[model samples]
Target: MRVFAPLLALGLMASAAHAQCGGPFPAFVKGLKSEAVAAGHKQATVDAFFSGVQQDPKVLKADRAQGVFQKPFIEFSRRLISKQRLDKGRAMAKKYDATFKRIERDYGVSRGVLLAFWAFETDFGGFQGDFNTLNALTTLAHDCRRPELFRPQIFAALTLYEHGDFDPARTTGAWAGEIGMVQMLPRDILINGVDGDGDGHVRLKTSAPDALMSGAKMLSHLGWRAGEPWLQEVTVPADLDWSLTGPGQNLTVADWAKRGVRPREGKLAQGGLPASIILPQGRKGPAFIAYPNFNVYFEWNQSFTYVLTAAYFANRLEGSAIYDAGTPEPGLDGPQMKRLQQKLAARGYDVGKIDGILGAGTRAAVQAEQKRLGLPADAWPTMALLNRL
Candidate 1:
């Protein structure tokens, strides 16, 4: 699941309305109620859904404080794919073998991938969050920064409630209004939900089969190719062109082998499928040959660390060896990243904004600066890079 940044400016703008509508929070909910009715939702259903919904300050706090997004890839992966999570995933796989098989046959998605998402999203159904789905969506939609993204979700949640999928009072999940064991958004639930438990209804919170199969359905719809590996841990030659090591640089296996790229654990077949080299921790750390199917991971979540961690976890569940990267140097924290971005901008690098998100533009600027400074242009930001900047 992707974490969203809170719209503090929007919150400030809505302050006067908040004072007028009993409070900004209540005003926001009231406005959503009017919009819901105008959008063809039954008044009764809307009322019932928002029966006791209130603006949760904690939701805003969680939205604004997404620390995991700023962590280094290895550290994030270690925390996400722990031995406990792996063991529980294996147990769930064994316990629901038949359901997984059925889902695979129907959706052509790997069971391991589904389990990986489930484990990472909510600890394999252990803790799917405690925020009210209605309140969260309403709060987000009322905010201006991502109103376009959350408004539709609010309506989708209302539709689900009207269709008797789950009680609004009981429908709880992440701060971004993601429900179910796999933390699916309300829009995804309305579009890609599936009845995997043969219960004639999709209940993602309780039924493992339902959640897993629903997740599989989502991946399938997102263009997951059957029988294709998402990524392979590979070793890139030291003298290879480091600039080619990132997303969108698709090259065939033969092409990569010609450039001295080889799998760390297995031999690359001649004239193999197209794959992109990904240097998640720069040239000093791990390298991977990401296949075309890897795009499905992005569709699942936009965070590169989250996508790689989920893909690596799924591969591990399928009996692949752990990543063979060396210990990476310490990376920059949020403030350090912002400072680095400022330095790069000072050097006339188009890093977009100094928001400290480490997005593609910032990374590309880093790569350019590294090459200019005669440093290894692996594009991974570190404290060393910041100090030099």
Candidate 2:
């Protein structure tokens, strides 16, 4: 379930109601440079870097795709863990066993979680997003929606250039300016980026270890307990309180036990872990009693469902208990999802495609769908809606 993280003011992208382009680009670019100067960037650094840069509409479009699809919890978990990816991750795990173990030993994050992050972010380092990081971030900064967030990224991307990670021509990544296997933003890289390979300079431009280790460092900073499990897949009480699901609301593991929420596999831990159970599909779906570590994963992307997927994938990579939540409620099944897609398309929605695969695209469509149905379409697809469809 996507518990909206209070609608951040940063990173808002283009919407269907408006299209922004051209003529006003230079003014926007100058605005970012001015803000960068205010934020302690050298004026020349900002000027030379952004003077000739232009807004990338494609990057803006990609940002729009951020939460376009919504999938079943199991399918979303499966989406990032095909057999080949898992095999490659295992191979990396063993090949880099010494390195990863050393990282885990030093940092307290598990090797499996490390590799799962590796797999999740870049598909074992196969397809990091391709875009000029400097140009992309500058464009995003100039776009008016997230100038504050992306402006610093633009400055930092320039810093990466001055530091010799890559010339401007070579540096590129996800439209959001996140590079490498872990998809970190330029600002994140500036603060948390590491030099894992001992290559004199810490660089994510070409080093997987740098990226992976840096990601671990970020997660660790976000409060991942060295040996603590991010979450426990569990059978939440049938009558579990809905009000206490998100952060701030809490329960002791012992209190949860008193309420009969047990670990889906082994014995649930005692009340030491602060936790809450989330019903992603409302009722009749898998439940996870998440801890602080889960919040660490959420720090990467503020989606409850994404956190569950990351933790679940971490479990699969680790040989831990797999969530067996019986059957999903009849929410958005294949055919139903397709119809929703078509409905979205007919209504002039761009949900990537009505391919019947619920993903970021479908989620956007569902949010649009919910708005149409006058439902609280935070874009979470549950099984009950499937039967109704």
What lDDT would each prediction earn against the true structure?
Answer: 0.79, 0.66
At residue 161, what lDDT does model 1 achieve? 80
Model 1 per-residue lDDT tens digits across residues 46-86: 78888888777787777777666777778888887778888
Can you tell me which runs of candidate 2 are displaced by over 4 Å? 1-23, 31-48, 237-248, 332-389
**What is the Cα-based lDDT of residue 309 in candidate 2?**
77
Best by TM-score: 1
Give the distance in Å from residue 32's predicted Cα in candidate 2 to where it truly belongs.
4.0
The prediction achieving the highest lDDT against the true structure is 1
145-229 per-residue lDDT for model 2 (tens digits): 7655565556566676567664566766777777777777765666677888898676775787887788788777667788777
Off by over 4 Å in 1: 1-23, 267-272, 327-330, 348-357
